[model samples]
Target: MDRQKRQLQILDHVDLTLKEAEFVSVVGPSGCGKSTLLNFIAGLTPVQSGAVEVFGAPPGGTEAPLGYVFQQHALLPWRNVLQNTVISLEVKGIAKAEREQRAREMLTVMGLDGFEDHFPREISGGMRQRVSLARTLVDDPRLILMDEPFGALDAQTKLLIQEMFLKYWEENRKSVLFITHDLAEAVALADRVLVMSSRPGRILAEYEVGIPRPRTLDQVRHMPRFTELHDAIWEDLRGEALKAMQGRA
Candidate 1:
């Protein structure tokens, strides 16, 4: 499909029968059009040819209310955490009192209870990302799209957020389309993992993660099968990652 000047072709189509409460991860080498596909779903970019259906409706035309967390926190530095979170609802014409109340409830869930009045500059990177998640979740989206939502955090923070994400997912159970380049992250978080190839991206492999849930970062690291799956996916992604790096170099 060609939108504007960009072309998107899903050479190896992977059908996603996401249930009401499942987390699905898409992992691929950087620049494999992962973000592009997410944009198509978000209606930020139109699907020129191939169909994109979310909850049985074409996304670019009549999509569900969506909550997206990008690679960056994308929080407004000027707005305090609470104010920043209410932007989306405000745009939708939701009342200030109701939205703020909902936003506060979300902030509490994300561990930012007392920090609501703090500016984005006042918080740590991980906390900023949490604020970003809070901002998105306040709207009660049917499906949340996460594009490397924790890619920029430190290793320790990444692990913390991964655990936090698991807790949140378990509680909310919203259908998720999480895109990440981190193999372990995808394996640790998703019910099914979609692996894609390089440019003119195609789904190369799809693996259903049979591991038991409430999986913490430590438990995932220690799982015997985790190493096996990681190695297998890494082997698949290595060539593409190297190719992408070389192109950039």
Candidate 2:
């Protein structure tokens, strides 16, 4: 008989709560298990030794409606823009007519209305990300887990997409757990911002973002409260970030 080996991963002392229709953001240094936290909640991986619940039940249950968007836009090359947006609904056995109408409406909101027939490769990275978002939002999951969904884009495009994302979220108000390395982005969009320690990750600190709702990127950035929250979170994160860098070094 051959012996089997198993690998173990741990997230130490992590505790979090997200309320109904709340948008929470998590920020941390690299390799701090920020993405792992999202994955665990989304039930992409099994939860071990911790009480993890979504909607009063353990994660991964069919009753818990959730959506996840990864950093990479995992669009199918073969699918056109409209086709990509409706794939999730199609999987759920939605009728073609209803799903198409939903996809079209979502694409229009995402500013991809004119490029419906274009394939993933035919669109810009920003547009592909929009389609990815459209696909995720088309199903209207009660909870959404996003892992640095805009980290790959250039600065300008990232800002544009961030504003667009906030617009949708403000309107729809889904419970979102957004994971990002960008502290400002975290503060800009979240009701509460969580900071995590280096590997063997745990929640180090959290700041309640006091900025008003219905926020615009330009307006919110200039507010004193936004600066206050961002700076406080950064102070907590800087040491852990340095530790991560030194560990890598």
Candidate 3:
């Protein structure tokens, strides 16, 4: 397919599967179709070839709920944190009181308890992203797609949110497909990390992250196994990333 006067071939011969409650992370060179893959799975982008399914059905074909947290929080600025979080439930025709209750519970879990009534403008970017996460989780989706959700935050805030995210995932065990350029982030949060080639992206390698669960980002980094996995994947990713940069230049 052509995008903006250029033929944009995003995926080629890419076959992937995510088991229930699996956490898989995809990392690749810029413009290597990481986000594109997520969009396809979420049914936001139309697929011209090959099958894309969730829960044994075409994307959005099943009754299973799906949640997405994008790089941009995409929260409605007019709505307070609570109202923003409950928007999905409201769309599903949930009752007002019940939606509010659920939203409050999720916000609390996301560390946004006292900030519920605060507008998005009133909160920090990290907090806004937390609200975004709470919004997605409120529906209790079986599958969650995150497209560089922490990419915009400062390092400290990013680390904090990452830990919080790990906690939530460990507790709920929802299937997640996380996309990021940060190799460490990918390795730390995922059960498996997939590396992709540049341009018409394809899976170049898949590395199983054998690090034990109930993991904190700090603790994971100290492990020799984590370093070994990160280095190995970086070697494979480095060439593709250079090619992508050269193409842009």
Candidate 4:
């Protein structure tokens, strides 16, 4: 199907038998339709052929809920942290007091306890992304689709947030479809990594990460297996990445 910015054609199909509480990372060269796959799962984009499912049924046909976190954070500047987190609940018709309480509790988990009243403008980039994460968790969704949620953060802050995210993921246990260009990030966080090739993207490779849980970003950096996997994937990606850059030139 045609996307506004990119197109997707899933062929020789592969399906994710995603069990509950699994974290899966998707990586690909630019224009590989990584985010488009998420949109198809979210029912924001239609599948031209083949089936797409969420919670054992077609996405839009089921009662399951999905939360999305974008690269931009997308938090409202006018709203304080707590209000921003609760806005989704409010829109879903949840009671005001209950939604506020739940939203604050969610923020605390992301280490934003005292910053509940802070507006987006008043917070640092990392903190804003935490608030964005808190907002997604507050909805108590079964599935979360993250599209480069931490891509904009500084390296130090990205490491910190990545660690914090693992903790949150371990505790809450939700199925996630995380999209990223960072190969290291994919290996560190995902139970399985799906790599896609450039434009009209298709899954080129899928690797299962057997690493144990509570793996910090720093730990993943030092693991031999991590390097092995990283290099193997990069060997495939380097060509695609170079091709993409050359096309731009």
Candidate that scores best on TM-score: 3
Alpha-carbon shift of residue 9 in model 1 (angstroms): 6.1
TM-score of 1: 0.91
Per-residue lDDT value at 53 in model 4: 83
Residues 1-249 of candidate 2 have per-residue lDDT tens digits of: 546745545489898989999999999899989888887887788887787999998888888889989899999999999999999899989999999999999998999878999999998999899999999999999999999999999999999999999999999999999999998899999999989999889899888887888999999999999888888888898899999999999
| Candidate 4 residue lDDT tens string, 1-249 | 545765436433546667788899988887777777778888888888778889988876548888999888999999999999998899989999999999988888888989988899999999999999989988988999999999999999998899888888987899999999999999999999887777657677888988887777778789998999899889888887887778678
- C-alpha root-mean-square deviation, each candidate: 2.7, 1.9, 1.7, 2.7
Candidate 2 error regions (>4 Å): 1-9
Clashes of each: 0, 0, 0, 0
The window of 10 residues in a row where model 1 has the poorest summed lDDT is 7-16
Superposed Cα deviation of residue 162, candidate 2 (Å): 0.7
Clashing pairs in 4: none
Better of 1 and 3 by lDDT: 3
Ranked by TM-score from best down, the candidates are: 3, 2, 4, 1
Per-model TM-score versus the true fold: 0.91, 0.96, 0.97, 0.91
Give per-residue CA lDDT, model 3, range 1-249, as digits (tens). Answer: 655676568899999999999999999998999898988998888888899978877886657689999999999999999999999989889999999999999999998989988999999999999999999999999999999999999999999999999999999999999999999999999999999999899999999999998998889999999999999999999999999999999
> Between prediction 2 and prediction 4, which has the larger TM-score?
2
Residue 93 Cα positional deviation in candidate 2, in Å, after optimal superposition: 0.5
For model 2, where is the 10-residue window of minimal lDDT? 1-10
Q: Return the lDDT, model 4, position 149.
A: 96
Whole-model alpha-carbon lDDT for candidate 1: 0.86
